[model samples]
Target: MTDAPVRTDPSERMCPSTPKANATVFLGMITPAGRVAYVTPPLAAEVALAGLPDPTEATESRYRLAGPCVTSSCGFWTGDHCGLGERLVASYQETGVPDEAALPRCAIRRTCRWYAEQGPAACPACSHVVTDAR
Candidate 1:
């Protein structure tokens, strides 16, 4: 039999590392030591942006953001899946993907693009990513 395509709920898919224009959900802050510390219950990115007097404080280097997943528009979209999420999970598999119980308390897990495509495996790898490394 031919392979059946897996259907996903596309309406709510959230891109975990979106640009400021697309960002609506504040995912978390990148720590001083360079690890992502997730924020739960999903805060609006505008609230976080409003609190920052300095524009630099709103940078991706300091905070992670999430927004509506724009497939094809994004470079990481591999037609039906997120190429970046797949790569991150594959690379991190050498270490280990966390159990569901051990995944971070993320703001957008329910609709997160990486989580939706890669399952719990994406979380551990996602925790270490910075949207803007500079």
Candidate 2:
């Protein structure tokens, strides 16, 4: 018996809440309800950044971004999977954990690091994550 090899290709895993320095896609905006109002097809991060006239406004607080997963370099990496994703799923399990059918429509899911490792369980938790650059 052999265990399947873990997929570690950086190109195939996206960080759904990356900082501006690493962001490639503007995933969504956090709405008044505090849940992410996801971008359906995904927009280029630069396009969104270019339109933001307020240089003083921090992008992380209002927008969710996606970028290549910096697995080991990321604080959320737990060697085998995302520690943050694990924690989020674990926390939600104590409450009403959404099923795969409830997953939100968003770009990068095919390659999202959390979704890849944690499956549909990551979506519900991810919808509420606001990137804290501080």
Candidate 3:
């Protein structure tokens, strides 16, 4: 049998092709209240099954479910690495949260990486808990 590709940690895979900060985008899951709850790669199998919101149909009213985080807070963040966490923090800080009443349905519910990683639990900051809508 042929050998499978070497499996690298998420941090090592942060920038495979380029050394620039914007070379690649790291995925993260935030809350409806504009807080970064989790961060990981998009290709993660668990992410694909946790159910995320559709970017096309996503409205500003919807919670920012997945996106690139700035490098500072990213698990892979480093001086020589991309600034994904910094970018995410900037974006989140600039945008803030949307109106709670206008939040839209999550499209990636079955494939959300954060949900799969964290499971249904209360958010540490707001104490808001996540439940499977399905």
Best by TM-score: 1
For TM-score, candidate 2 versus 3, the one ahead is 2
Candidate 1's C-alpha runs over 4 A off are 1-10
Candidate 2 ranges beyond 4 A from true positions? 1-11, 53-55, 95-99
Residues 1-134 of candidate 2: C-alpha lDDT, one tens digit per residue: 12222333556688888999988887888998899999866677777766667745747888898888888998888887889888887877654656767788997787898888878888888998999887
Compared with the true structure, model 3 gives a TM-score of 0.24
Candidate numbers sorted by TM-score from highest down? 1, 2, 3
Shift in Å, residue 109, candidate 3: 23
Candidate 1 per-residue C-alpha lDDT over 9-36 given as tens digits, one digit per residue, 9 for 90 to 100: 4567998888788888778888988889
lDDT of 2 at 8: 32
Would you give me the overall lDDT of model 1? 0.81
The whole-model lDDT of each prediction reads 0.81, 0.79, 0.32
**Model 2 backbone overlap count:** 0
User: Candidate 1 at 8: error in angstroms?
Assistant: 15
Q: lDDT tens digits, residues 1-134, model 3? A: 12222233343322221112232222233366654343332333223323445534322222223333344655545654444323433444434444544333332323333323332221221122221112
Clashes of each: 0, 0, 29
Give the clashing residue pairs of candidate 1, or none. Answer: none
